[model samples]
Target chain A: MSNNYNTDGDRMIDCFLNLGELMLRAGAEVNRVEDTIRRIGHAYEFERVEIFTINNMISLTVISNDGRVYTQTRRVSVAAVDLEKVARANELSRQICAHPVPLEEFKARIADIAENTRHYGKRMRYIASVVSATAFTVFFGGNWVEALISGAVSIILVTCMLFSDRLKIRPIIAILVSAFVMTMCVQGVTHFVEAATMDSIIMGNIMLLIPGLALTTSIRDVITGDTVAGLMGICDALLKAFAIAVGCVSAMLIFK
Target chain B: MTYLVQIIAAVFSAIGFSLLFNIHGRKLIITAVGGAITWGVYLIVFTQTENVFLACFVATMAIMAFAEIMARIAKTPVIILLVPMLVPMVPGGDLYRMMTNLVMDNSGQVRFYGHQLVMEVGAIAFGIIVISTAMQLILKMHAHITEQRRARH
Candidate 1:
């Protein structure tokens, strides 16, 4: 029994290392990144696998090997070196293999992300910048109020995630932050435009925030016969569309 | 004459923008050249006949041809060059028009215009994708030949 356990543990570590390499090759493809992460998570037999965007603004969908899926939005920061966090999650997964993990560990994990968000902040900043610029340009037409709103949201998200650097939160937090920041910036821009009745040409530019890449990539992936990868990409694209709508509606409701 | 300036600027801007976006390799030059040709064709056709569709079709063909030439010459990813050049031409304005019309709850002609708007935007995306894909195929064939040559050497 002891020997079997040792061999399994060794295999799990090897699998995770391989997954890390695959992720490096995938570049900025979110589906490829998530798929790689899922491969690692599966090696450990994790019940719930999720990659959070670092901004504490959006929590991506939860993917489980059990074929169950759920999505949520939350502020999760990476506190420090998340190897320990992964180790802890591994332990919980093992415990739950025989019995369900205590809710306390989940709570602690959430708290950890909140506590050490800064180390993850810079990693998140780049993706956020791309997204925000896309959204800002698409929705708002060089309006100061729109700029202020986007700037405020960016600052708030960065400040919130800055606490977790010490905890070494998961790198996936960056993706979440990017998505949220972009959505917020677009919404902010749209609101400012509507308020000021800006020109359509300017407002059109902000539509760059739309995940046209994801949409096209998903189509490509599906055509290329990578169904799992394609599905994840499709899910991401759909979620962003939903998020854009939500942000726009929320801004409308709040501002009005 | 002003159209000529827009064409030159578009081409130069596409190249400059690619550099600004950190896209490197021969594909960038190809994309810039392609954008210039496309712009020129559009200007010429539009000026001569004022036929928007014909001009757009000619521009698309130029872009497609340039993409193929660049991909083969540079031996790099076609998308790296194609996407940036297409950026200026994306039908963002149409999307905005559609959304505004929808928001305003315009019916009849407004609704008809909205549908047209969608088709135009989709056409831009479809055109870019199709042209790039065709270029990618040509590049793949070119790559195969180069591989064969290298093997013989």
Candidate 2:
């Protein structure tokens, strides 16, 4: 057996990768998401773990369930200080990943698949929200310039996502970046395509942003009797769609 | 030749999309075949009725039936299978058409194009509803049949 002491940085990166996988399985079920956060936090021996979805509109539930030791939940939004909170989460992940700890340090995490799922879901939701928002920005402007700017924004966002391990950018920013990318895509297609045929060009591209998968999955969740999760997932999809529409309309008004 | 190509493409695309979404095995194959058959039905109905909306509605029902049969045989998740199956039918091109019309300032065909857009969106929604309802019914039937089979034994 290799007697190697893993550092905090190593644990954080492992959690980061696991977070992506968890999100896909659990979607946004807070219980599962909270569990995932707890497992990840415990791996680094952090006392508290909080994951939130902050958007331009609507307050979100902060689902915090401690393993009977520390648990709390509250409503939160993206205020000026929220940026600091995100920065803190990023810093913790970065610090932990930089200092890989002993393998035994993650024993709790290995035994806590439920927690991993929740944390992953929370992470994915954060990514999805931001991506949707950015897409909205480009969607509304609907011009060659808007498209170019959006494309640039998408490039930056995707770069950040790829290097999220090194950069320690929180998942929430990734969500916003996705929104930006969608916006850029719609606008960019419209920009390059002839003005006489821009409507189809824009519409075709924007369809990719449609939460068809989410919508269908939500209904399935409802049918399978996971009503709470289903309702929340549907609500999240609706809110995201509304946000994209709002961004689009706002930009259109500005451009017009 | 074009219609044949469309059918093959729809099937292959449905299968590929399903795989991307993590569907596999017999159910996945059923979905792919179903999508191809639905596409064929869509072509025939549209040619006969000359109503794209109606053709789409009929095609949706046909595929939903296929999905139900596959779900019953497999006893696996229906939505997981059904969703990827419907990917090919999603009106990506129609959406693009509407957006292009709006952007290009083509005032002459605005009314015609706008109506088509609405109809296409509606058709997609209609397809989803039919498939979900069919799945629910299939589940109930499977339960009932299992009970009967158990009693007979």
Query: Using DockQ as the measure, which candidate wins?
Result: 2
Instruction: Give the per-residue lDDT digits (tens) of candidate 2, residues B1-153.
Output: 667656765665565444434343565677678767777888899999999789877877777777667766766434445665665555544444443345456765656766765575456556656676766787899999999999999
lDDT of 2 by residue, A1-256 (tens): 1122222333443444344233334233333334445555544444444443212211122222222232223332221111112222333334445553454543344335433212223343334333332333233334444434433444444444456535655444444444445445545555564542233223323443455455545655566455666677678765654444444444443334
Candidate 1 chain A: worst-modelled 10 consecutive residues by lDDT: A78-87
DockQ scores of all models, one per candidate: 0.08, 0.09
* Global lDDT of each candidate: 0.46, 0.48
TM-score of candidate 2 on Cα atoms, chains taken together? 0.47
What would the DockQ be for model 2? Answer: 0.09
Model 2 C-alpha lDDT versus the unseen true structure: 0.48
Candidate 1 on A1-256: residue-level lDDT in tens?
Answer: 2222223333333333333322222222333334444544544355556653221122344444445554544332212222222323333334434543233443454344334422323544434433343333333333444444444444444443454334455333433443344445555566555643333323322333355444555555565555665566567765764454444434334444
In model 2, the Cα lDDT at residue A86 comes to: 25
